[model samples]
Target: MKTLTAGRLLPVLGTLLAALLCALGPGAGSASAHAALTSTDPASGSVVPAAPRQVKLTFSEGVLLSADSVRVLDPQGRRVDESKPAHADGKSNTAVVGLAGGIADGTYTVAWQAVSADSHPVAGAFTFSIGAPSKTVAEVTTAEAGPVVDALYTTGRYAAYAGYLLLVGGCVFAGVCRSSRPVQRIAVGGWITLFAATSALLLLRGPYAGGKGLGSAFDLTLLGDVLATKPGAALLSRLLLLSAAAVFLAVLFGSYAREDGDRTRMERRDVAYGLAIGGTVVAVGLAATWAMAEHASAGLQSWLAMPVDVLHLLGVAVWLGGLAALLAALWSGEPVRRAEVQRFSRLAFASVCVLVATGLYQSWRQVGSWGALTGTEYGRWLLLKVALVAGMVVLASFSRRWTGRLTDGRPAPKKQAPAVRAVQAATGAAKAARPSRKDKDASPERAAQLARQREALEKAAGRRQRDADEGRSGLRRAVLAEAGVAVVLLAVTTLLTGTQPGRAETEQRQSAASGGARTTAPAASGPAETRIPYDTGGTNGRGTALIRIDPARSGNNSIDVSVTDPAGKAVDVPELEVSFTEKQKNIGPLRTALKRTSAGRWQATGFQLPMAGTWQLTLTVRTSDIDQITEIRNVKIN
Candidate 1:
């Protein structure tokens, strides 16, 4: 029982793995492209030293200005930035926002949306305070997307990918390698699945992007919005490519399936040639849709990256999908030729080499560093994909060994078992009826001849059973196992497609290093956040001023001030200055010149406090050209 279980384990595992692969392939079609916020002039959560002329944003990739939108508002939700389309600077990913008028003191929120170079739409918002944050009416209302909607979107994408592979693999397998009924069926199914998946994704995009629930997937209004974008356009292109592929597939299957191969060899050869040329062209066009709508067309070196990604997709389809076809042929209750297996094996090897070369380039481009492989979600999934593919390669080598057995003449033993059983029956009966068995040599009586014949038949049947069962190698088991592991690899590949790339972190860190206060003196790092409010008396009367100190607590801090009326209305004060004194340490007053950022905001940076203690800060508020009032406040630092 142990031996039998051990012998069948690999094949059982293979079948199960294929099933899991089928399950995994559909969800792997998550957004291949993801956009990360790189940097803004006033960093997210950074208190600027002063209000700026304009808000500048730099992303990791060049984006579509028309499809992207940006908005900036003060604490009162009054639009401070111009309400118009944002534009990208020449050759740079930076988007510039023109200020509508002067900005006042308070927390300001910048909400933005962009269609990245990879054609995926992404959005986010961030806040920066002036003197301090006020009761800002601004909110990040888009909120977290529903999990069900996300899952459905991802599943639809993966389904399309799976369908693409099946259709493409079936063509390569049937046209060039060998023809089989089961392979054709798989190819046909692939076409249908691809069509369905594309339709579903096209409909789902609008709702998903709008942050609507799963139930809104069928919203026609949203669908129209999706069709107007790049992702939708890519999917539409894929459908057209699939339609062309269907025509080629029909021709190949029809010609190859005819029984009179010898009589119409030339016609079939022409069809095969057509498949090699036309099919590849169609496959490349189809693959381009994915690449253009994915990471390959975004971020760094997009032009060169796109071609590599297209090849990578094609290689994967041939290798992984071919394995699936091989499994079908093997279990088709017909002889699988050594020639067929060897042919596929060679092609599969070349495909794998291409996959490796392209995959390495992609990994380097997306991950950026070795640490990111473990540090980022995308990296971790890539690791899993590599490990699974490695396991499948090992299993495939074992299956290849089984294919070699076809030439070793091992199958002859089962064929000869019946002939050997007939001879055994005659010999056994003669021996049982001999005189030597009954007396000394045992001779059998004529009256018991029928019983002796029956005993001999039983003995012969048992011997034949042993012969037929014995030495029947687990070749089927190896193939099944190989197929199963390959399927799992496809699933892992799907997951990697949907994950966020690690390169995003590398870009963001670099952007942070060069932004805002981080570029100056001891202010190389942002100051801690602290907001202090005080009212300056006059006709601008009892208004609240918010003070923001970056790295606010100790060391070097950058100061910003925002003045607003009690009700949070902008009050453009004329002149404002701040002085810091560490009184307990007997430190003299250190005055920093204020730079006007906007009408209500002032910035002063690069003031280093030598010690940690309670510091007295004085704000000289000039309401008019002549009248100035001083407001004093104490701030503790450690």
Candidate 2:
């Protein structure tokens, strides 16, 4: 029985030990994640001759612009912009600010914090020189950013760690607890901890991602808005999936455990429960990864990018949790059926493999190039995580070999005792006749006794080997330790994802460019020459007025006029009037003399100008003798 037990456990122990070392290694550090800033306006640092009338910013995705979306400050740090920032031309992704009049010649810094349509907060500041400006004023105070948001962010991470620990611990307890009652207690605690952690994450999402908090928790309007945004939609979908998983777990706990079932039935129940719990945890992990990617707005169809991320997170949870359970089984030594340990070991091995594969793919996608791995903070952290995972694989391999050797049953070597001498006269006479010194030293009785001792030594060696195998339970301890390290790595990952990666570098590049200035020469141009003529077909208020405009260049020109009420039964007091720029002016109280020529036409020659550029036109229409309507049209000259 001892031999069989030792054979069964060696493999499991070896695998766990390897995993622990991997978790503690630098690879764990490299696996952190976060969003990156792609671009900004004012080109980071720039110089302009005059104060611009407005400031505009464009982002990688659509953004929601409101009163606090952006702020402009003078060199002395005084607020300059008066009106709240608004979406430029109703574009959701662009923010525009109207500048106040007092903006003088000086260096001005534009500090902006925009909430992406996906609910992620992105902030940046740029210095733009206004006529060799120097003083700076509009600084972003940390308090205005809100304390609740920061606290929520920190708490959410801590809760994730706690939840992970409880989950692993519960799995361990379930594997090894002698009493069903203790197993139930551990399971319940695990679920409760997981629930609390997930809830914390949900609450923190709003504030950390630039939302208003609990008031918006159940706001259907906010939900609708979130759905409209890609990041928000993805997160909401993941949460719903997680909720479904939670429901499945509840049902399994409430109904499945109560059944007295055969092995097959029990196995089915176990699978169902595992799926439910695993799915929920996986969904939560995917959502976290999405938040880290910063491309939350990519929509649900971004499966090509998201699947690896989801798999990476889910695989980590399964591998870590399984290791904990397996370790606990080994530690208890009793009550842990060997078959159960073997089953769990197989599952854990598969999970570790999956984790490694998905992690590699995700790392490739995020880091982009080997240079980024060494040059960027995100890349460095990812490298650390990869190293840890590699170490875990090596450990798992060693354990697998140990388990195989133990499980392969082999009998202990046989022992034989020397035959006892026959007490015959012939044998005594033979021994007396050969009584030399050598014969005395190598007596038959003594040789026979030594043979018996050799057989005993072999039996003792077998017993000791069996005991050593049973006592060396390092694998289980190593697995549990690895899981704890994984928790810390995950926390660091969360923090890295929260920070902006290339903001400082971008700012520096902008500053260097602004230091140098250049000037360009204006081109010379020609002069303007014009000619005009007027004619009348009749003398009465009903008469036709003709005017022509002939430019020296013989190109397109325009004419305009203002006319008063004409006293005529046919004309109806000149109710409607139209005019073009650079044409006839106010001609009379009753009529205006503007017309096209034979060389041009008989109509208002300059009225319908054919050219490219802005062409201003004014129109007046009288509703009644006392009431009138007037409008100006700055038509596009092109």
Candidate 3:
């Protein structure tokens, strides 16, 4: 009977794993979710009896506020806000701005912009009313970084990624292959590219964040302002680390490379160890510059995500970057040592392991549900990246097979050496026949003939070398194909960084659905009750908030709120605030003042609801010092 061997099973398992991830990778995640507006005081499209003291905004993650982070405009497009936006109640994720006293309100517009913890800028506009909702001339300006600035910034980001891979990979290749000049040149090119790209990004950041044109990139004041923010600070820190990297590179290619052949083995070993440690520090530092400012520093498991992200980047640099160096060495007309190739193969295998483990964890973090993984654009992009990585793995396997053949002493075809000798003999004859410029007896026509013969001999030598490098150059061609796939992989990764994380998009979609209009039939003559589920994404954060409104019509209504754990047990929270808003006639975020009555319950007596319609109910719950969520739901009032 025929049976499946381990080799056959390996491919089957890999196919199954890919299928599983494509269908069920919701638990795999990314920390780079863009910040989402969770709840707002007064609620968008609501009307109030009087102008609010301030407009408050809450987000899913921390945001960096600027002078004009939140702006309130009157119906006539006049600024009515205090101009300085500050964190509400010392909360890093909340922004609040005071409105000018006694300002007449109609359909007032609120425009807000902030840089999220992941270093991406987000902006939005909404309308609310006081006294009555009316037509307003104040228009919401669509906030966006102009096309020219966006394209330039994105290009800079791509260059930065490429430069980092080249710089780190080239250095590693030099260490492993012991072929200094060509690989070192690759490293130097990487450093120059990275340095230039980083400088450009720093200048462009100010304009990018503020949605300004490219001309504003050079504004000194804007640059100063950018320097104060977390993202800007991260970029500045990267610049400093790059300076240290320069020193590291100089030592590696200069003093380290120039070590005398007469030196003792012990001395050489010690010097190599020191360089390894120093290079590691510089490499990890450079990786940290990105981790601190991007997705790793923001979302769930952030404490662990940052370090893992650094490792992920280091793995990519070592494998893809090293592959590039190896490719260059193969085609440089230099004899490549068998041991160097074997050592790099081992390192590449190890790097792939690290990448896989960390990548799965990150994927789980960025995507929390199957729906999110399959439904969002971010998810689609991630799948594409996975497919590309899989292709690379296939190509790598072919390369490994060729490497094994070389190591196992498989004899290459015997035609290579004779080809090399023939080319050398032809080149020698051409050189012997060429006459020096000082030989006045030689005619110009004879000299031209010799030069053409020399060119022909060089071309013949190249063709011969190409024919027998390793019996059709299997290893060389395989590595080349792998390098091509890696280039595409890196581009996808750069684009992924700019896309919104699937988890964030899912949350935003849910928020919009919850806040949408509800056309429920008028309630009977009794209390109207609703149970809304809330998850703050913290410890014991999943639960239901039970709300009941007594005598649910217009005028005064009594509200009672009770919180519960997922297991149906009462759970007490640090704080809870509820507000109601009516969108049709544009009335009320009539906030309720509640007093605690029990371990997980609160009641507000004789609160006014005024005229009744389909109203939005917003509930804010804080579970810990930093864990909180705002939920909005629609309710019908008689």
Candidate 4:
């Protein structure tokens, strides 16, 4: 049995050590921050007099760059960029890439991807014209990473969370309660899981950021390049910290256990203090790895946020992870002392307080306003997490109540008696029926005393067993329920890391509304078209209306409109309306007399524009009998 256990454990330890070493390097944190594209030089869809020397990009926050962070491609989808992309003017928030000298005077697409300050990858693509807009521009996908890589990376994140909780919480349980083989195994499992997950993340970062396939995870060149970036460095730091954690675990289950029985009070106290201090340092370092790389590292009041985030993570580990430990102990078929359960309850309550305070601050920073709480995807996930936490708290209350009734409403047993020992003793006595001459020569009084003592011990054991079974039943159920809810809560929390913060989403939408409202410069001989997206609060009510105005100049023009769903498939609607209003001069909102020309196309002829300026082109589309949405875009009438 010993050999089997050691054989099984060897592979796990090997995996943990190998992965941790592979990830050893400099840096701190994970991919938690989001970067937004704030502006671009020459601007998207703008016409410049001559070919520009370089394309410049400015982001909402600092970004980590790579050789191919920014790419410039011609209308034919061919690369036209020359040198590697670099920060403009040594500004971390700005990126500049040189364009090929004397490139064709046509539209060019710029695709960019960069690591945000918090380690998350951000990407986007846009088009600009040198002299004249091309007949057709290449469509560049701005997805941050491939779907497969994203799924795998996200799974790694979830596993990391689970492992951190188990490792931290299990240690706390052993220190606060009594140590057990089961808890030690749980902590070790956590360590191995965390190491594997971190290694997977470090390997996947290159492909994830570059939007490459799963096979790219093994590219050493790419891995080295990733290690140079903040995200890569953060992952490496986490791995190094895990090495320290391994030592802590060794001391926890090995040295600590060996000294438990024979150590003097003073010596035991000293060892405990050492364990406490060392454990604290290890826990804080691990928590800091996450705080320094994620949302807390780059957002508002980051100086304060990082520490608060660490506290929050520690609190979560204690409460949720401790719950796991408690459940294991309850179901371990051993009598759990009331004091231990009470101690954990108090510890959990304190952790809950810390979680509440930190969670509120994080929510305020990310959501900003109540409207955003319901408006954005991140906000909704946060709300769900909050709900799950509340449920867990309710379950915790039940556990606490059950704890108060532990030991069968009696004081804890001074020494828990094991029924197995009594059974072994009884079996030994039966086997010794034919005693040796020395045993037979013993006094009858001595034999009577031994029998009486054995009977008393057996009775005590039976009572303890009954008390334990009755007392822990309710507490076990409550803790199990809480643990179940905690799993779901952790999942939601992991998902939120990948989601855009509500505050960022709101700001991006406002920026788009103000800056990208107008169409590209009109071509010399073709119509000008502006696409407007709309979404009504109904089923299948979201789509885009592509409106084109022929001979888009002053005075008379012909208008055509077509609607397409999110899949880019044309769809017919119940009704469509087109109107134009020049806000500067308070010109008439000349409603176009549009008629259906095909399944999803509408056209109107001889619309009088009267003046040349930026006009608001309003479009209303009804996807269903009652579901309709209206959108307005700024269109040039010259």
User: lDDT scores for all predictions?
Assistant: 0.66, 0.46, 0.78, 0.75
Question: Which portions of model 3 miss their true places by more than 4 Å?
Answer: 1-32, 407-413, 433-463, 517-638
The residue-by-residue lDDT of candidate 1 on 372-414, one tens digit each, is: 6676657777878777766766676566556655542333546
Model 1 lDDT-worst window of ten: 23-32
Per-residue lDDT of model 2, residues 51-167, tens digit only: 788888765446655466678877566788888988778866578888898578876666666565434565544456676645443443311225466666566655554455445
Model 3 TM-score, all chains together:
0.76
Give the backbone clash total of model 4. Answer: 3
In what order do the candidates fall by TM-score, top score first? 3, 4, 1, 2
Best candidate, TM-score-wise?
3
TM agreement with the true structure for every prediction: 0.65, 0.53, 0.76, 0.70
| Candidate 1 Cα RMSD after full superposition onto the native fold (Å) | 19.0
What TM-score number comes out for model 4? 0.70
Q: Which candidate is the best by lDDT?
A: 3
Question: How do the residues 246-281 of candidate 4 rate in per-residue lDDT, one tens digit apiece?
Answer: 998998888887756577889988888999999999
